[model samples]
Target: MRHSVRPRAAALAILLVPAVGIAATPLRIVAEDYPPFLRDTGKGLTGPYADAFRLLMRRQGVEVNYQTLPMKRVFQQVAMQPGTCALAVNYAPGEAETLIYVGKVAPITLTVYVRQTQSEPITNIEQLRSRPVGAINIAEIRDLLGTAGIAFTPVDRPALGIPMLNAGRFDAFISDTRPDVQFIGGRGRPVKAFTLARAERWVACHAAMAPATLAMLRRALREGVFAAETLPVWHSYGMDSFFLETRQQWLQPAN
Candidate 1:
């Protein structure tokens, strides 16, 4: 009778737990429509960064609801909205006020997109001195270009820089490798990329969330980000030029 009684108690306890697991937490994933990085593929959210984030959260026992919001809306909501997080973001100077940097998703490597027929081949940023280049004012290399005497006109959007370069407005345009590669190639443009600096990008959450939430996230990043299971997450985005080890060494401090 004692053995039968113990078995029945254990079965009853199992029924009390939620199907996702007792420790699982509900989370919301937010991102701007940054392609090849974060975008809606109609199968929920799927991109290189978004896919990796989903896999990380799934391993951490997080049930996620993803939404595509404008950059303004995403910035407004993620800082104070509990259980909400940005999938991929750069570490800007002012963001520390409202968000805590939890994990680095990857490094953003900038490059130059030059039209083959119109521009000379270039190997480095310094070579562009006195050359008219189109770039965003806030790009990481802005200071470098300034000091190097490379002049550029600021474009309102990243994609705009591509066609402006095609129209011969500037010798080259600066943009991240993935997007510039995808955007330029997609349009059947002959623009080629020149490697630039690599900077860290991260996943950040609202500051108002519990400390335990951050701990769980950090632990997930530590255990799951570079694990064997994570490799497929990148390949799922269908990018062959995306190297696996490009930022692989940054995993330790990125957490």
Candidate 2:
């Protein structure tokens, strides 16, 4: 016959067993067709920034699911929904308080492109004062141009801006490095020249997300796994690195 087990021994055994009920929350990430950095491969999503985000989240013990949408909708949905974040957005005026910035994953150069045949180089904002420029209908761009005293003809989409630039509808078109490169690279038409005038790209989170979640995202980006090889894809379009230099530059101080 087997001896009865001691009550304390049974209690200790129960206490030693690990809890199996907890589940990790899946991070829902929103991105657009900003290629080389974010693109749809048909098989799924693949790009330098997307890949880096995936790697970082995994290291932080977070599960991630990515969904692609139009750039404009991406921002809107993130702002309206909880448990959502958008990548590759610059610091804009009104957006500062509406979203929490995780970190700047790359330096985005907002540049002007004209036909290679054009001889004059745009070296200063003053040069654009009298000329009409093209830009996407984003508030930050409009704000930037307004602050610089540069006037622009805004287009609703980046693809439209490129063709209009080629057609000479505007004196020049303003675009950031990644989307611009992807637009030009995919186009059959030739681009005569381009030059970077400013640099600004950052990862922004929805206001609906908790402050703690934002902090976790920031920490993960700083200490998470990074692949140097993957960074070149973004560098191809003029991004310097996969992580921004400091949060201060990309984020506002807490009130």
Candidate 3:
């Protein structure tokens, strides 16, 4: 059965507002090329999370312009540009003051991937200490590793991690959960993954955004646009549990 976040009376009124009357300037969305969430496929921006965001904005009669860039650049643009937002941004202490999170997009659990030949069993974050590890060069993951007192080399992309591991660049690679790691690991280069950290990623906008615009986004999110649009994609990935668990976060607006 389909479910939506229960809305407050005020927010329900916002949702009821006519889409045609709310036509305003297009919102500029800055996104990272994170596969299965947001990707630039060389043709255009397309991904489950990105599609859901686009759908909500369209339903609200708001035009949006999307640009794909490195995750680092995505954060920079959203921080500096007014009326700009980023998709699936993990919350960080330093960035919290600079950004206003509208709602949770999805849950991202970081995993440690290693060559199948490795002997040690790594079921926790402390096991990664002293071993060579590489992770995407992003502040969120860096903060995660830093908090655990683990050091890691920063890889420019997640796709590069497996190849680098095969070349012995690092003993382990930390990345978001991906199903194709086994295929990418290939013959004689099998890979194994361990859960390291878990957290939620959100749709965050610049602090300078107009209050009305922000309200519209919050309204759409609280009304369950995230689940409505991305449910199929999550199902396709066999992650119905993730979708079910995150529905609670969607009910509450970000502070």
Best model per lDDT = 3
Better of 1 and 3 by lDDT: 3
Which residue pairs in candidate 2 have backbone atoms (N, alpha carbon, C) closer than 3 angstroms, thus clashing?
A: 115-192, 116-192
Question: What is candidate 3's lDDT per residue for 37-69, written digit by digit as tens?
Answer: 566778667655665666577667896778898
Q: Which ten residues in a row have the lowest lDDT in candidate 2?
A: 1-10
Q: Which residues of candidate 3, in runs, are more than 4 Å off?
A: 1-24, 41-43, 166-168, 181-193, 223-226, 232-255
Give the better candidate number (1 or 3) by TM-score. Answer: 3
RMSD for each of the candidates: 11.3, 14.4, 7.5
Better of 1 and 2 by TM-score: 1
lDDT of each: 0.63, 0.61, 0.68
Q: Candidate 2, residue 118: CA error in Å?
A: 1.8
Given candidate 2, what's the lDDT at residue 61? Answer: 60
What TM-score would candidate 2 get against the native?
0.63
Regions of candidate 2 where Cα sits further than 4 Å from its true position = 1-23, 40-44, 136-139, 155-167, 178-197, 207-212, 223-255
lDDT for 181 (candidate 1): 35
Among these predictions, the greatest TM-score belongs to 3
Residues 167-217, model 2: lDDT tens digits? 778777776643433434544343534553555566778786887778768
